[model samples]
Target: MKTAVVLLPGLNRDRDMIAALTKISGTPPVTIWQTETEIADDIDLVVVPGGFSYGDYLRCGAIAARMPVLRALKEKAERGTRVIGVCNGFQILVEAGLLPGALMRNASLKFVCREVKLEVANASTSFTSGYTQGQIIRCPVAHHDGNYVADETTLKSIEDKGQVVFRYAEGTNPNGSMNDIAGIVNEAGNVLGMMPHPENLIEAAHGGDDGRALFAAALEVAA
Candidate 1:
């Protein structure tokens, strides 16, 4: 599958993402810099990899959201392109307005880095179809602001629509997110945003391959 990863200034996980995707899909992913005004033609999926984009200034992803590449990202998403945003990438999606809610500082106000247990809330989305509903997946999360919060009404609507795709397991909430939500999908299911680093779990080098299924799912969808 032909996949593209947008690389912004300060992007640190582009190589990690490319390595993961190359292993899972047997194809090297292209890296598109944020300054590029156009995404490559025939790209099957687009990933906004994790990093302190724009040095996390003015909020984690605020500045990067307005970059030239994001304009193309929005257009591609609108055209039903598969998009996945991880960690700071998730922050960028929210700031870009492609996804809702904002990622805020951990409720306890500390940076967190650890393996987290997450339950698959809904396995029907293109990005998560590899897991069963309620299955536990171990993914690493590293960030100072991984807490996810939304107004009650929006949260309720997300639940009502089955858009809440992943949640920290009971009693294992690492960031104090509302309802322990770790990831969510859009109504169309073509776009996904999550705080966990699926790329980190993609190979035996990382001690596990639980997240390989996520990229597998993306490849299947793209095919």
Candidate 2:
């Protein structure tokens, strides 16, 4: 599977995502800079990794969402290409209107960096197919504005459609997100946005490989 990693100002996790994709898919992904206006048709997956893009000015991912690359990304997603946005990337997705809801400041009003338990709320999506329903896995999160919120109607709609893919488990809701949502997929199921940094925990050297299955499944490769 061919993959591409988006590079934006202040996005420090691009290298980690690139390494993880190369290790899992056995092919290095092309790097797409913020100014690029098009993504190759052959790219199977495009990932927007985590970090404080634009130094979190205006809001997390607010400026990055307006970049030309994001317009290209939205086009790719509309054509059914797979897309994953992690942490600040998640905020960008929502800001760009590729996904629903908004990511607010952490309820604690401080930065949080720790491992959290995640339950596979909907394992049928492309991103979560490698895991079973109700499975719990450990993933690390590092951010200051990971809180997710949506209007009541939108929340109910996503829940009713099984769009909520990952939820904080065992009282691990670090950000006080509504319904403990940690990750979600778009209505078409081709786009995913999450606050966790799966790339950081995808190897044995990182303590375990619980997050490897997600990348493997998205790339259609063995975990």
> Each prediction's Cα lDDT score?
0.89, 0.96
Which candidate wins on TM-score?
Answer: 2
- TM-scores of the candidates in the order shown: 0.96, 0.99
Runs in model 2 deviating more than 4 A are: none
Best by lDDT: 2
Name the weakest run of 10 consecutive residues (lDDT summed) in model 1.
214-223
List model 1 lDDT by residue over 1-223, tens digit each.
7998989989898899989888778889888888888886699899999989989999999999999999999998988899999999999999998987889999879888899988999988888889998999899998888899899888998899999998999577888999899999887888899999999997788999888888899889431
CA RMSD per model (angstroms):
1.6, 0.5
Candidate 2 lDDT tens digits, 31-79: 9999999999999999999988999999999999999999999999999
